[model samples]
Structure formats: structure tokens, C-alpha cells
Target: MKVREKKRPFQVFFHDNAVDSYLVTKRATKKVVASIRAAYYDNSSKELDARYRGELLVYQTVKVRQRQAEHAEKFYSVDDDHCDLQVDHGEATKRWCYYFENISVEELSHPMNGTRLR
Candidate 1:
């Protein structure tokens, strides 16, 4: 017998925050400063290290995050019978339930392309 299974989906949350080394004034104190590091890598592994200035390299990092989110969902239908025809009573209903619960266009395309929903 052929076996089929369902898959799970996922999402990624990228945090984009940078520190400015210039100066913060409160109407009373004013100071000038320079950037200590040209660039640095964050925990996300998305940021470049010592290769970029402020915000100039953020677009590249955002693209990485977008790609990651595009392939996050996972799930699949069981078989042809379970997905297409209604053969019997119990099997038909059971398969229908499974089909709705797991089967989706995204899941179907993922295996072939290794990603979900473009």
C-alpha cells in the first residue's frame, strides 16, 4: 500500500533595527560621534559584517527574509482516491476530511519546487 502524510507550515519574523553612533541630544546636551563598526552580523545571519554602511545594505537583508517566508507552509493530501473519487462511505468521508485538512495548492507545489506559495 502507498502511504501519504501531511506537512506543517512555518513563518519567519526578521527584526530590523540599527544603532546610530552619531549623537542623541535632549535640548541640553549635544555631542558628535562616529560609527565604530562599518558593519556587523546579527543573530539572524542575514546582516553582512563590516561590509555595509547604515541602512544602505538593508534591502539585501530584506530580500533574504522575503525568500525565507515564501517557503514556510507545509501539508499534503493522502492519495488519488482520498483526494478525487468518493468510493465508499467511511473512506470517502475520511478522505475528504483529510483532503481539506492537509491538501492545498501550496503543499502540492512545495515538493516539486521545494517551496510554498511562491
Candidate 2:
């Protein structure tokens, strides 16, 4: 059988809440923060670190929290799945439940070429 994909069908929000050196390392321009060690709560399965794997939980947005976080980023692929997911199950309304890899500020600045998820 074909192996199941581990990544979520939706995109994720990257909030840097002074949680660790994540802000500092993520801010280093022209460099790659290779290992983004994070704990994604409210989720289960091979979805994450084995410590919190396979929990398979999801929730809705009751509210939004704004912070004056000096270093924060909404890590998203411009070539994203905004138009693919069910309208009622909007990815924009979720929180703290996914991962982003091999991203950089420079890449975010330019427009991507191909259509997404084709």
C-alpha cells in the first residue's frame, strides 16, 4: 500500500512567543534554521515528535490573541491550499496545529511560479 502522508492537508500559523531561540534563529537572514524543534499540542499520530504523536485532535477558534511579539511569522506557502479545503472547514480559523519546513524570509518575498497542490 502507498504510505500515508504525515503532513496535514492545511497550512499553519507560526507564532514566535519568546518560547525559545526560535525567534532568534528564525530571524537570522540568509541562513537556514535546519532543526525547528516544536511541540504541536492537540494533535495525534505520526503527526509530530513521538512524544506527542497520534493524538488526532482539532478545535475551532473561539478568540484571537494579539501580542507585541518582536519576532513572529505566519509561515505559509503562497502557493497554498486556501481554495482547496472545504469552505466551512477553513484553515484560517484554526490554531497551533502544524509544521513548516525549509522556509526563509527571502523566499517569502518573491512570488512562487506554479499553481499549488496540482
The TM-score, computed over Cα atoms with residue i paired to residue i, of candidate 1 is: 0.23
What are the clash counts of all predictions, listed in order? 3, 6
**lDDT for every model?**
0.40, 0.31
- Which 10-residue span in candidate 2 carries the lowest summed lDDT? 1-10
lDDT of 2 by residue, 1-118 (tens): 0111111111111343443444344344213222222222323324543543333221211122223232233333222344443333345334213314333223666688787885
Question: Would you estimate the TM-scores of all the predictions?
Answer: 0.23, 0.12
Best by lDDT: 1
> Could you give candidate 1's per-residue lDDT for residues 1-118 as a string of tens digits?
0011111011111122222211122111211111112222243345434356435567767888888887553323245653554445576568767767775633454347556684
TM-score, predicted candidate 2 vs. hidden true structure: 0.12
Q: Tell me, by TM-score, which candidate is best.
A: 1
Query: How does residue 87 of candidate 2 score in lDDT?
Result: 31
lDDT of 1 at 86: 46
Clash pairs of candidate 1? 7-74, 7-75, 39-50
